[model samples]
Target chain A: MRQNIITRFVLISLAAGLLSACSPVRDIRFRAHYHDANDLLYAAAQESDLPYLKAHLKDGGIVLFSESWDVDMQKEIVTGDGQHFDFNRRFVRDGEMVVSVDSVVIFETNKMPKNNDQSRISSLSVLGGLNTALGIYCLAVPKACFGSCPTFYLDGDQEFHYARAEGFSNAIAPGLEYTDIDALNIYTTTGGTFPLTMKNEAYETHNVRSLKLLAVPREEDQRVYHTQDDKFYLARQRVELTSARSGNDDVTYLLNKDDQTEYFSLADPDNLRSTEEVFLQFDNPGNIQQLGLVAGFRQSLMTTYLLYNAFDHMGNLYGDLLATVSIAEDDAPTIADVLYEQLGGISAYLRNSHKNEWVYQGTWYETGPIAINHQLMLLDAAHPEEEIHIKLEMNRGMWRLDYLHLTEIIEKVVPLEIQAERVYANKKHDEDLLQIMLDGDAYLVSQPGDTYRFEFELPAIHDDYELFLSATGFYMVWGREEWQKEKDLYSLYMMRHHPGRYLKKHAQAYKEYEKVMEEAFWGSRVKHQIISGHDK
Target chain B: MINKQVLLVLLMLLLAVSCSVPRGLPAPEELPYETKGTAFYVKLHDGSVYRGELIAAENDALYVLPAENQHPNMKRQSGVVQIPWDAVDNYRVYYAHGKSLVWFVPVYTIVTFSHGWFAFLTMPFNLIATLTAHFTSQHEHVLRKKDIAPEELGLFARFPQGIPTDVALQDII
Candidate 1:
């Protein structure tokens, strides 16, 4: 009796497994839930309770509550591994919104393991060989394996794409068939647009049924680290360099002998004057505080200049003096000059005369490694997740770019040991405290409307050292209330980028730019001084 | 009588058909909302508020009968008020209306015909929904704020008062 009961239990289990193999969840409507409440939404959708539905969905939380545009899925699946679905057309209106996918394909092709009959024959003896033959027969013979393959055809086309399903922990019973959807590996490519198109690369045109649209709420924990702490943010990004504008004559990307990728210079080096722009596209381009560019090549006296402009996915530009970089024309050592001056030697005269000869007149061996950096606060305090588009315009692009580095803007404190004579604090007015900074860490503790001032005295400004500021609070120009953030402030005090000289000579233009920027956007603050000798 | 193998095959087919039936949106009566004479509190995007009794809600406009106690400032339109859908952000009703058991009979019948095999297997649970008009009741108001999320703030804008400090501030100094 016990044996009979065990046999009956096994038979029941087999019947249940066979039925589940063909079960399908059809036309499942994807309902968007607030990210905070998403933990409970999948369970609530299964019930018919009106109160739960209204609380979780119909209010401000769900995407359907707002107006939405319709998008249809691509009907035919491509037979190769590189087929792309076009979703950029539908998402052109609102590129910032989150995407919601409605349908997941059910019927899919199975990927079976390859068999080598010769290798298997040596391992199998009498009983093992018989078992292997029976297994092969069940898998190869369509009728023997039952209904678990990708042969389902609906309305002439296949019911779903052909791909192997992912294996879960539970084991399948004997004689039952299963399909894996993961082998299809469908993905959406945004191409700088919302609702990125889905690409399926499996070898077959799978059938598509229905799809719907919804928007997901912005995730609560989304954040980027500020580069102030010198934290490494560039390691997370994947870089792809291409021509700014689409054309056959644009920049060419090449892989060298060491497997390093770099942009190859044009065949005619003077072709750098052409209007072709080199574009650097970085993934997850949000909250980028500083972009560092280093060019490694063999140019000496020829200073190559690059102009970079930033835009968003929707083609909106950002920043006035966002960032600019240039390679210096000459790289010289001071010890050689000093030794030549003492000895009054031939090398000393050659160093003084020939240093700038190649820069103005031009020579062959003027190529070497040069590096420069530009810093700009790309995102406002409110919307930091905006993507950045970097357009590198080659004013003189004969050199090749090795790799570009991007850093986040977090906090780090570096003390500039400048002595100050006076430190003042005011509750109302903007004061200039450029005289007396004790070269020590200054502290500010006051109510919301209060301001503090300090001054630093230094050797006559020869522009030898770059200036940096570390502060815990920030203020808008002329005390604007709308640009106030209490207790969180960071600013970089460096020389402003002008064509020839710093902002000192171009004070009027710099002040006008500052006014426009204060009225429009915010960025790192800088102090201006008219330094001699380097003004040219 | 059918053989055991045939019986097993038939049972599997029934399961497949029952599982494939689609689940749809709930019927109107099954929704949790007040229907008639409900008082509404409407807040506009520009910080305006309206409180009155709802007379009729059309697709384009809502006709409020103007509760004498509520609208003290605005002039009424011939003893009735018409609020366009565009002007209002959203509104919340005060009370909950109870649905009757008769409203669920058609829904249950439709579900039964669609997935009769599954319905027979899960009849004990369906009994609770089919036997009552009000399966669940909630008096809470469904509220929606007309404010943009922090992620949508302008590039140069700052939150002066520091709205949500618990969430990290986006500070690009």
Candidate 2:
């Protein structure tokens, strides 16, 4: 018994030592190039000279590598699907990338928020006399649609119209991905070389490419769908399978142009009204039993507030939200529009009348898309000759389309383990807020949330003072009261400061810049005070 | 009972932690009891001294627009001094009562009445608080000055005495 105890104790000690060795933290003094353990490598470097990662380098931890490049954002467009576009920058320095730690590479897009400004006369109700007068004035002055809006076609047959290009039309090149270094997510790569590739092959031939490389299965992509009211609607050539599935159960695939993968996108009417109609047509395969829909949804209150008021000066409040998905078959009577009241909207609005005073705030939901199956064979056992029609419509709400599916096969879906690779580090205050700020160690990890926390050593100055924590995520900080309904983390912000490289140059213009900071802080505080019922 | 005790302890800990983060300035009063204008003095890292009326205070810096008329010795160049908080070695603030009662009484009366009759009931407390702020501010500044070392005094070192007495001091905010 005594011998066995001695052996077990030895084994435990060895295991503990191994665990400590595998930890990412290592003494900076032990850097491969450094010779002396007692010498402080950062002692000679001025605070201004030190980059963020180097200045905040902990005694025994890995530091993130930071670099910056100027990105020309003029009329730039980014593809919606998340994937890494190749940057194609060749590095001369050659070293084996050992354990790809966190990285922060900032890009200076310098792009302003999308302007939501509209002519005041446009806000008048359509029936009001002012609207008619404004229309006459616009017609007399210049063509209302001159270079602003143009007619377009959806397909060869259907006519599509838009007030303006649906959204900003900047396109990112294939192979380039924007990380917005200022809002970088800290990631811990599990012991790997740089640029590791991860592919999730759920089906034998259907492999999905995720933005981040991992050695695990990918999360199901969010599919967006739209619907019209309770009538049977159908359109020809609605879906075409790019790749045929192994088993034939009267099922076909629709491809996603963004991801270049198979999916079933519903036919969108664009206009969300009872009078407007959308139709989809697919060749009838034999013996269809059931139809499935993979639907995706996310909502943000801030975005909803902005998008809802984008067209109107102050038209409608929360009462303006209602949407539905309506489907039908070959003019056979309509199904009641399935209500979708949980979808989110987005917009960019100026906090003040000043055009440049835009502040963006909104929420993105994580409740993934669900698969809903409806019994198709129950309606008519043998209606193969009849073409199927589907319609999607909404009253006044906004949502993205996922996918629509028609299938005879039904199988229980096995939930795959999807590990979230992105997380924002947010630290809470303890008994001593100042001390907590000084420690620079404690932090909480939040995923699918934007709030991030950082701690720095307080300068031992003679006067009591505060410094701004400058970084590049969402620039505007939402007050606690303004976002009370949002259960996610709220970011802590000081006065806004210039970016790292521009700090010195900005200080030269400090006299004028100080006024801007004063106004921003005062504006924030006054707004908070009024909203919190302490108007005085 | 055990769970309740644990929860109570946790709540106390949270309260203690929450109380530590500094709540900036007290809320503005419904009645303007403050009769004086806010005064400010700052010593910069580059050994410059600015003494004048406070223009603005923010997390980034304290701004002081030079007082227009002051003792020749105390007057500074005509421009706002933006002392970045990190560059400030020492600073002081006080209330200067210039022509207090002239505009103070009228503004206070109009604002208080506008708020409602109940606002009148709180006038006494506001008055006491304002008085306390005025009388004790300079003394507090003197105490805080001890933290500044002689080398960090900058232009303030030349003026061993307090602000010059040539100009008549009045606080009219």
Candidate 3:
């Protein structure tokens, strides 16, 4: 009975299996979450929230963001593993639900432009606008510029240019010299109108109070010329080396280039006849040596004036004349002699008449506002106790003291004998101090009839240096009631673009430049650029 | 006669065939981004940035160069450039493996037809689009697998720096 029962059960089990196998199957599907991958991409586009979108993508997704501007994924797939997807291509399906990105084909087309050369990139959409010039600079800095750029103290010369590149860590080019006029890597801006600036190549700190757009270059790997002119109270001048030795010794300078021998002067009988060279002098006392120019004459003029810097399309600075008047050939100071030494000996009056009714001579001079306009300040990464450079700019109708500068030390102080590791404070990869450099300085010039106000928002006295404002205005202007309440606003940009640890002697010239430009543009619209220390 | 036994047998055969594929299509399961088309980034012998979209990436062996090929000071940033196979550091490319375009059809297309050849033809397009968008270059992203990741930079790499110091603002904290 047991055998019969076992046998019967086995037969029944076998029959059941065959029966189930022959039956038709209904459709079945697995549970899945709705994933609109496009939503993440769209979110990234809308908010520019790269990190969020990046979270969803894996493997090569990050690489795509750096790929061609034209993003597509339809016709075929060229993966990283040397494989190609052609028309009528066949692929096999595995039984696994897990998926992956095998590879990518980085096409050599339609990439985001790495440089913004306005001349070449007439197409505006992704171009870095002039608006971001300050904001981009803020990358290295924590704050935006306020009334003026702070005094950017430095360890070297001013009037230099440096190259910057995006996504590429090395923005600075390898070539120390600028090449390729077509690529055009250098740029400049004009402030007043006369003197054109030829930025020096030396490395130094700069106080960028104000900058006029000069030229936008096309190449990323090009050399830049550093400058020493205070971006604030800019005194624009041009340097043309007609004959480097013409105005220095027994040589004469003429207003019109066609008639080189037609200059007339009143300083000495031999002033025009004995010029050996013509040196260009600026009220802003920054280094002139590193500018990579042939020999020329230079000096500091006692007065303030107006001038703007303009470079050629190729980023070249040439001295241009604003106006000129004829004088006796022998009356002007010889070009060889320093300006301050012979300015007094040189008499000035209109060619037609004699009273103090005067026009500026075509000589190289720093020109800004009679009253100051901006105050920028910068600090050194090595030292803060020493005064470096003082620069200012002329704006509207007045001059603004750009800044008083001091060295910046990242570590503040280091033990003298200790072979200690260098401490780096400002560490943002995208940061370029040039993009958002700032400093501090005082301005005495206010727009006509209280349209504007001026005061020192920072302190400059370390008691180690004796800084004087006698030249700017011996008469102390009021609003003392406003001072204590706003210690951060009433300060001045003392020095900029120089070493701070040196004696106060270097800052003396910047102090005087402030005084003269104040008198030059007493009532123009010029105002000092002051960057509030407030960082948001 | 053809009662429950036949039904059971039929159901077993159908289920076995259906279970052959769970995900339906074969693809790279791990990649965040997929290639719709192939293109190249051209870094001229002279330092400049250039790129293209519908380019190819095959065995043409005409224009293939690494990224660190163009800059004199490549150590600082070290860029990548593409050059012609024959030309040393500057040239164009013609690849055997090429890129494809992604065509976009709206969701409204589904309502236009729900049956017949109209829906049938549209059905193929939808299938193709669904697959195409799945692996397109535009939709790809990075997925970190290794403990050590390669350094990545943002868009600022394209700009050059050249401002003079006198007027160059110096801000350090």
Candidate 4:
């Protein structure tokens, strides 16, 4: 019937539209943000011409204890069997002229890309002989190790305001009067917010504690996690903002070491960052505030060239574009005495390297890791059994954790997903086996095969220690190239139900492929140098 | 070996001929031709665009430094660069027979104003050298085989120029 034909046509068209809408023609031009977004790091051997030493932190790594804080990073990473890898050398073409580094990713750190949001900036007056710098804060991925970085207050003596409450309203704190009001702002290499703060501003008749400061989450808002026993449970500790709001009004939370629960935040618009301050505005209010800028005078050719181009002194060219904006403050905590509370620091750098998004795209190498794509990537390499700081600078209050790590029980646990545990232990052609355990039952996830999920609940076991599996090599995830943007709804990132071991055999060629992949990883940088040298 | 009078006459004649020849003039036999427009030289960071005869280059930061000196061999430079996107304006790739007044210095120095750091004491030396080169230098240059136009560059000739360059330049770079 014609009716049936029409119905079929409608369904096909709808499906086509949805698919097309999913992936728009992406236009990634070279902008200032690119200077920082290009975070693919390169640690070439200082003495060797190998280009890079490719190393990765294992699923469960050594327990590292911070002598200063008495905290353990290694212990935090260890789930079942601690694993780590360090590639001594990757490229041999440079005749030992270049050095390479093993990449180590600091897990569950600040990985949120820069985005748009309402920003709150501060103004601090200069005092003679004071060494002060603006902190960089990144709006964090909610519920991660660190919830988000705090945006720092900058230099000057003026009343600052921002939309911290549910809506926008103009506000200024007491005692911050300036003749010039030259909007002073904060800066950083990697921007973010602060963790703890105390402020001093003139108060009204009510008392000294009437002042409040407000900051907005720069990325996505936070999502709270709790334990079954009526306690907070999280993978990492964070500063959380809880609020009750009115029209164009915000409540600031101020911590009283005297009374912990009497916290109140101020939501004022005078604190809002405006063109009068940063001299830029968004076409849309939802865009992430462009508070931090990456200032690089030197960089690698490939990172720049691959993004768009590389200019020569003699090639004869001129033209440019720039975008700048202010960060918004969302959470407002009342400040009883202090006018502004500073959260963190800021900084920037150049990669001088390029990620070959084009070359390895859509190929077998594109999934980051074939069997299981790495939604999470760490950026440190040659990670020793020591606590390395995944430093962040921001301008907001730190993600506060009331009680923590209730869910983090296993000494070693595996990702429930990921098809192949294809690991190639390159340095030592030694025993190739993976360790695993589940519910006090010692079992191997795999020696060589596909990794499958199993539900194991043991009541009698208090703490399960070790289990084993076999892998010719290990697994990997790459950042360069357009690894699929956004995540698959069904993708397995973490163990959803309970934790267990997984094992699978990597094919022989997969090992070769890994070596070749490592070669490709470093080989591209070599080509960058060659093309760079002898510039016409 | 000839008489002194004959030698004097020869010397005067040679002087007259040398004076008659226009000094510091460009070569008429420049081998008139065009260049193939290939890769464009863009300032990093800022993303400024420019096109011209890639006469001489030195590395700096992430960009190539160009010299305005038409005499490619004499072009002395430092390896310094600025991301064009970081800067405010764009310059055109135009030079007549040689370098642009603007392009003569590396963009890095121009952008960062690092030349100011050379100090007032050293400025006189730099100024003197620049002036000396301009007055005493022979500026006309020959095009490289690669710079010749693959397509007819005749159309480029009609456009009003910004900083005229070697024949390889277009109106806007």
Best by TM-score: 2
lDDT of 2 at A16: 49
Which candidate has the top score in DockQ?
1
Worst 10 residues of 1 chain B by lDDT: B153-162
The estimated TM-scores of all candidates read 0.17, 0.19, 0.17, 0.13
Residue A228 in candidate 1, Cα distance off native in Å: 24
lDDT of 1 by residue, A1-536 (tens): 23224544753554344223212211102222223233333444454541122111111121111112222224321111111111110111312233232221111111111222222122212213323443343222211111111121112221112111211101111111121111111122111111111111111122111111111111122122222122222112322333222133233233111122334322112222222334443344444454332222221111211100011110111111111111223443222122122212100000112233211111111111111111112222222243333444332223333333333433332323333334444422223332212222332222322323333333343222222222221111111122222211111111112222221233343233322221111111111111111111
Better of 1 and 2 by TM-score: 2
The per-candidate TM-score of the B chain, in the order shown, comes to 0.35, 0.34, 0.19, 0.20
Model 3, A144-224: lDDT tens per residue?
111111111112211111111001010011111111111111133121221111121111111122221222121222222
TM-score of 1: 0.17
Each model's fnat?
Answer: 0.02, 0.00, 0.01, 0.00
Clashes of 4: 183
The DockQ values of the predictions, listed in order, are 0.02, 0.01, 0.01, 0.01
> What global local distance difference test value does model 3 have?
0.21
